[model samples]
Every structure is written in structure tokens, then in C-alpha cells.
Target: MPLDVESLRSHFPSLASGIAHFDGPGGTQTPRVVGQAIADTLTGPLSIRGSSVASERNADQAVLSFRSAMADFLNADPSGIVYGRSATQLTYDFAKHLSTGWGPDDEVVVTRLDHDCNVRPWVQAAERRG
Candidate 1:
């Protein structure tokens, strides 16, 4: 279906306030279901289980759920997926892995318009490896 602006707006409690939030580059908001899912994950009974078989199952299910969601979102293989706090953090982690075995003569190029998060980690890694 086409973008349901009103339906999507109903999900975000933050949008209910009269305040405006245009701090980021993108002027967008997440659906209420997304926020509710995060809240449920953090505060739900699934997290309070002791180290028992049931708890282990719950934890495994949570991981599988996350992996499946991520794979679907990115159209990527779940096995190749690695989760990070943000794209910057993820890029840094990938840079560390990909930069291994680089020689002193190696050079790296980073974009000017990219976030500092994306550039800083690769620069630091190149310096260390050099």
C-alpha cells in the first residue's frame, strides 16, 4: 500500500507533542509499532527469565527474531548480518575486519559528506596498520 501518513503518525508518541524535531539530516519518524517493539524488548517479561531452558529458548527466539527482521529489512543474508548500535559503528567494525593485512603502502579513501562516525574509524585503523 501507499504510505499511510496518518496511520504511521499515530504510532509515534513523540510526534504527539507540539515540539518539532529536525535535528537530523532526514526529516522522518518511525512508526509506533517500531517504538513499541523496542520498548517491549527492553521492558517485557522476555528479559526477566532466569538462566533456565525456557530463558535460553526465549533468548534464542529473540536473536532469531532480530536476525530475521534485519535480513528482511536489508535484503541480505541473515548469516552475513552483524548488528551494531548505528551505521557508523557498523562501518567501523567492518573496516577493522576488512583492513586486516593491509601494508604501509596501502591507501584508503573516505567521503567528505559522510558522517564522522564512518570516516574516523577507518582513518584510525589505517594509521594503526601503517
Candidate 2:
């Protein structure tokens, strides 16, 4: 069966603008439902993560739901899902963790096609470890 292009396009509010976005590095235009979901989460009952109180429990539930959803999307374990504020931050954190045992013979290779955000952190981590 052929994909329903019109049906899929309907969910993206940006489609009305007559521009087909193919941006990368940062994500492309998101669907209206996804944006609305983010707005709803931010507007809902929220607090620091914990289980001792109602607000905290609410926060904990949100975290759990996030991990579960991401795990399902990525086909990975929920416990392994680590959320960061940005892609750059996530890359930096991962590089720091991975570079701990690096020595003289070790090298980190970053491609020219990579975004600066992806390249800079790994370079810094390699320098620190070297």
C-alpha cells in the first residue's frame, strides 16, 4: 500500500506555509500535536523529581512516562535513556563519560559533516584526556 502523504502532512501545522522543511542538526518542524503535548506538559502540575509528596510524585510520574516513551521509540531500555537539555549537552556528557580511559594511542575522530555542537565537545574531551 502507498503511504498517505496528505494524511501525514495534515498533522503538521507548518505545512500550511507551503514550505517543505528538511533541516537537520537541529530537528525539522514538529507536528502540531507534539508541540501541543510539550505545552501541556509544561503547563501541568510539575515539581522536582521525587516520590515523597504529591507534586514530587507527579514529577516522578512524568519522568517515568518520558523514559518509557523514549524507550519504546528508540527500542532501548528505559533505564538507559538519559535526557539532556540539548543535543550539544548530551554529546558533551557522553564524550566526557567515554573519554575517561583515553591514553596517548587513543584518538577521537569527528567528521567534517558533523555539526559544530557535535564536534566541539568531543574535541574538548579528547584534549582533556590526552
Candidate 3:
């Protein structure tokens, strides 16, 4: 079945403004449902994720729910899901972790097509390993 572009776009209220958004690394506009969820969470009782208090429990549940949803969508384990502030941060972290296992014989390959954010982390990690 062909995907309905209009139907998908309808969920994003920002699209109605007719401004084309080509940037994803800087962060894409949130869909109405996601925006509403974020607003609700921010407006609701919030505390560090824990089970000691109601606010803490609420925060904990939000984290678990986000991880669970991501896991389901990615077909991965929820426990393995590590949320980062951005793709660059995650790339840097993973590069550093993986570089620790690298030896002199191992090579680090980065393409020119990769964004600077993606390339710099690997290069830095390789330098650190050396």
C-alpha cells in the first residue's frame, strides 16, 4: 500500500504554516501528538526518575514508556536503549566506547558524505585509541 503523505503530514501542525523543514540534525518540528505529550509532561508533576515519590514515579514511568516505545519501534531491547540529547552526542559516545576495543590493526573509516558531527567523533576516538 502506498503511504499517504498528506495523512502523515496532517499530524504535524507546523506543516500547515507551509514552511519547508529540511533540517533534522538541528531537530525537526514535533508532531501535534508528541508536542501535546511533551507539554503534558512538562506541565505535570516532575522529579528525578525514581519510585520514592509520586512525581519521581511519574518521571520514571515516562522514561520507561519512551524506552519501551523506542524499543518496540526499533525491534530492540528496552534496556539497551540509551537516549542522548542528539545524534552527534550518541555517535561520539558509541565511537569512544567502540574505540576502546580497537587495536593498531583495526581501521576507522569515515566517508566524506558523513556530516561533520558524525565524522569528528570517530576521528577523535581513533586519535584517543592511538
Q: lDDT per residue, candidate 2, 1-130, as tens digits? A: 9999999999987788999865345446778888887777778877788988877887788788988999999999999987667888998888899899899789888897777888999999989987
- Candidate 2 has what TM-score? 0.78
Off by over 4 Å in 3: 1-4, 14-26
Winner on lDDT between 1 and 2 is 2
lDDT per residue (tens digit) for residues 84-104 in model 1: 566767878888998897899
Candidate 1's C-alpha runs over 4 A off are 1-29, 46-54
Whole-model Cα lDDT of every candidate shown, in order: 0.73, 0.84, 0.86
**Model 2 ranges with Cα > 4 A deviation:** 15-27, 52-54
Report the poorest 10 consecutive residues by lDDT, candidate 1: 22-31
Error of 2 at 130 (Å): 3.6
Best by lDDT: 3
Per-residue lDDT, model 1, residue 50, is 44
lDDT of 3 by residue, 11-90 (tens): 88888999867645544667888888988998899988899988899998898998999999999999999866688999
Candidate 1: residue 67 Cα off by (Å): 1.4
- Superposed Cα RMSD, model 2: 2.5
User: Which is the winner by TM-score between candidate 2 and candidate 3?
Assistant: 2
